[model samples]
Target: MRFFEATHKYPFDWETVSLASFRKYPNDKTPHVQHVEVLNQEIDPETGVLKTERLIMVKQNAPRLMMKLLGGSDSSYVLEYSEVDPRDKTLTMHSTNLTFSNLLTVGEKIVYKPDPEDTKNSTLFAQSAKLSADGVLSRFSSYIEETCLKRFHDNALVGKLGLEQVLHKILAEKRQERGGAGNMAA
Candidate 1:
């Protein structure tokens, strides 16, 4: 008799997966989609179960004033941001719009000066960021480092218990159920 058992050794690496996915399919579309991202993963030694939560974000570019005049989205960029909540076992994704013209280079700073005379202009200007890809990337990376990491660990633990381990237990139970009720033939 051949015995088959599922283990928690399923392979996965987020950075590698992300890069590989992008390399395979590069794009400059209105809605940008990040790959199926692994927020966090953990394995239970006792149960031999793997737990993971995937996150994927899709964003549509917002039309800039010039783009709106020139036909929106043609000159805009959309970024999709996704993060997995390990603790809650949830996936979150959102799209943010950016103008191609407003992007700032790395190390460059754009300061917003509010005009006291025009309150409306002041409010708009105050809310606007430097609008640089580098700045956004920097902030995004920092957020992932600070907030997502801990949450991922917690999620992994929960998944190991609630999702992965439970799967194996159910499988094992099914196998046992199929083994045979009583007739022992020697």
Candidate 2:
């Protein structure tokens, strides 16, 4: 198993960042993401936390070796689970690939919260991921591990770019609504 973690600072407040995260898909930067289907969404009556389950379809660009081993699949599904705590100003999300589990599995967790030092205008985003391969691929474990880790790292950057794009769009809309100058704060 290989693990990786990344931290990013967003100039937008936590609320804005959280809202944008939910709308991150369907953006140009992440064309690999094909669709998102919400399986369930509800608010906990006792804690007032919002919980959601979603299925996401992504077009796979598997390596030649992986494609050969997995019969050349073109897409895969991921299951996403998330919880939002308004009172705590936190959003926690976890996702796992539903396909190719035996050959390769990628699981990721993300936490979004208000930056204590600059809660009004800044948010902190942290993510950690685990990559593992087993089963018939054990003989090629090293190769598989390396490929999966590199892919995950590259995709992490793309994910961040996609979120930033969504945040910018949201800010632009808010500015238009206020009839303010075209310049954005960040």
Candidate 3:
């Protein structure tokens, strides 16, 4: 088993960033993420927290050795769960792969919170993941884990860029709406 952790700062408020995170799929930077299905979504009336579950299909670029272990399959399904607490200004998420878990299981967790020093314009993002390999691939566990972790680390940067793109698009739309409304008033 191996663990990875990373932190990033975004130049956007927590609320905006949270919304952008939900809309991050179907972006150009992450072509590997083919499809996303929202399995469930609801708000906890008592706690006022939003909860959601989604299934994501990914076309992973597995290494040659890993592909052989997975019977030549390059696609996998991941189950993602997330909770948003507006009162706390925080969003937390967890995801794990459901297919080929025995050969390689990767579980990730992320937290997005308001940056204390710059709460109005900045957000803090922290992420951690665990990668484990077993079963017939146990012999190559070390190599597999190393490769998978490296891939994940690189993907993290791409994910951040994707989020930034989504956020920019949303903000631009809002600006256009306001500008159009003002023009009509004039």
Candidate 4:
């Protein structure tokens, strides 16, 4: 038997999801984006490079924005929020925006786990890519702009390992399966 401690409830901030979800909801009014202060940017001290997340930002207190994105037609309007606190922000949490449309359910519950080191903070965040509506691949690539992507050291092997390895494994399995199927047919 496995037991997990449930996290506390926090109103989901729709703004961060909204901008990242631009691909889902493209319109004339682009949610009035502004470059808010770089709250707590998650950086690798050893690499001297911004870690996996850097593009995400908290837009005040607009939890409804997520609803707008999830909801279609009538609910596409913008949701408002309060001022974003730089001190209360974190790159670990508010780093990548996800572009998922099916995540917005009216009565959906959001769970918040306060970082042990920073208790006063409650990020309207999902800890892992699998749990989040947007899968890991989409979320990871969305962080950097195309122009600057070249400068990043990790770009060279973007699809080399995961994709190629996956393909190689799939082909090998298919060959084995084909051989078995042919023998059975004979």
lDDT of 2 by residue, 1-186 (tens): 789899999999999999999999989988889999999999999999999999999996778867876785789999999999999999999999998886778899999999999999999999999888865456787788888798789888999999999999999999897765544543
Task: Write one digit per residue (lDDT tens) for candidate 4, span 79-108.
Answer: 211222233343232222323323311111
* lDDT of each residue in 46-117, candidate 1, tens digit only: 654444443443343333543454464433243434343333322333333433333322111111222335
Per-residue lDDT value at 72 in model 2: 55
Clashing pairs in 1: 59-95, 62-97, 86-155, 104-132
Structural similarity to truth (TM-score) of each candidate: 0.24, 0.93, 0.95, 0.21
Worst ten in a row by lDDT for model 1: 122-131
How far off is residue 148 in model 4, in Å? 8.5
Estimate every model's Cα lDDT from 0 to 1: 0.33, 0.91, 0.92, 0.31
Models, CA RMSD each: 21.3, 3.6, 1.3, 20.1
**What TM-score number comes out for model 1?**
0.24
Query: Which wins on lDDT, candidate 1 or candidate 3?
Result: 3
Candidate 3 local accuracy as lDDT?
0.92
Q: Supply the TM-score for candidate 2.
A: 0.93
Off by over 4 Å in 4: 1-158
